[model samples]
Target: MGHLSTHVLDTTAGRPAAGVAIELRRLGADGSSEPVASTVTNADGRTDGPLLEGASLQAGTYELLFHVGAYFARTGAGPEQPFLDVVPVRFGVTDPAARYHVPLVVTPWSYSTYRGS
Candidate 1:
């Protein structure tokens, strides 16, 4: 079975980005997106469970939207006029039987993500 999971790291704080809001969405052929799951990061910067697992894993394009603005504000690091607010990560899942660990390394001004182990 395949699985989908994620984690967030706050570059500014140099720690796991706890309490960051994240959303997983499936992209349709007509440029529409459907929300699949939504969750907040834990103390370890990970979701409580795999966002999509077992039979729910599908081969297609997906997007992960991170509420960077809210997260920075909660951490008392938000700027008066934020440069980077919501961060969107879009990628494709080609093999449903594989594990996908999408990780976001972020700060109040910027962010980066990659498919991890």
Candidate 2:
């Protein structure tokens, strides 16, 4: 079975970004979006379970909206006006049978992500 997972790491603090809000959305062909899942990161900065798995996982474009601004505000880790607000990591899922691990390594000024095993 395939699955989709994510985690947030605060590069500034050098720790997992716990309590970050994440929204998973499936992109439509016409540019519309459909909400797939929404959850907050646990203490380990990971979802309790795969956001999407098994039959729900599909081959298409998806977006993970990481609410970094709110997270920063709550943690008092970022500036009053954040340079990087709600960070959106958008990518394609080509194989439904493969595991998709998209992680966000972020700071108040920047963020990075990649396909992981």
Candidate 3:
């Protein structure tokens, strides 16, 4: 079976970004996006459940919205104006039978992500 997952790490803190808000969206063919699920990161910076799995997994574009601003604030990263607010990482799932682990490494001003096991 296929599955979708994510993890967020606060580069500034050098640890998992716990309690951050996350939204999973499936992009429609007409260019509109629909919400797949919404959950917050656990202590390990991962969702408590698979965002998508099995029959729910499809071949298309997906978007992950990470509310990093609130996370930064909660972690005591108080900047006058956060350079990076919400981070959106969009990627495609070409194979429904593959496990997509989109991990995020983020700071107040920057973020990066890639396909993982």
Query: Quick one: best TM-score, which candidate?
Result: 2
Stretch of 10 with least lDDT, candidate 2: 76-85
Number of clashing pairs, model 1? 0
Candidate 3 Cα misplacement greater than 4 A, ranges: none
Clashing pairs in 2: none
Best by lDDT: 2
Could you give the candidate ranking by TM-score, starting with the highest?
2, 1, 3
Per-residue lDDT tens digits for candidate 2, residues 5-115, read: 999999899999999999999999999999999999999999999999998999999999999999998889899987788999999999999999999999998999999
lDDT of each: 0.92, 0.95, 0.91
Native-to-model Cα distance after best TM-score fit, residue 60 in candidate 1, in Å: 0.3
Q: Would you list the rank order by lDDT, best first?
A: 2, 1, 3
Q: 1 or 3: which has the higher lDDT?
A: 1
Q: What is the TM-score of each candidate against the true structure?
A: 0.96, 0.98, 0.95
What are the per-residue Cα lDDT tens digits for candidate 1 across 7-57?
Answer: 999989999989989999999999999999999999999999999998898
Residue pairs with backbone overlap in model 1: none
Model 3, residue 60: distance off in Å is 0.6
Q: How accurate locally is residue 102 in candidate 1, as Cα lDDT from 0 to 100? A: 93
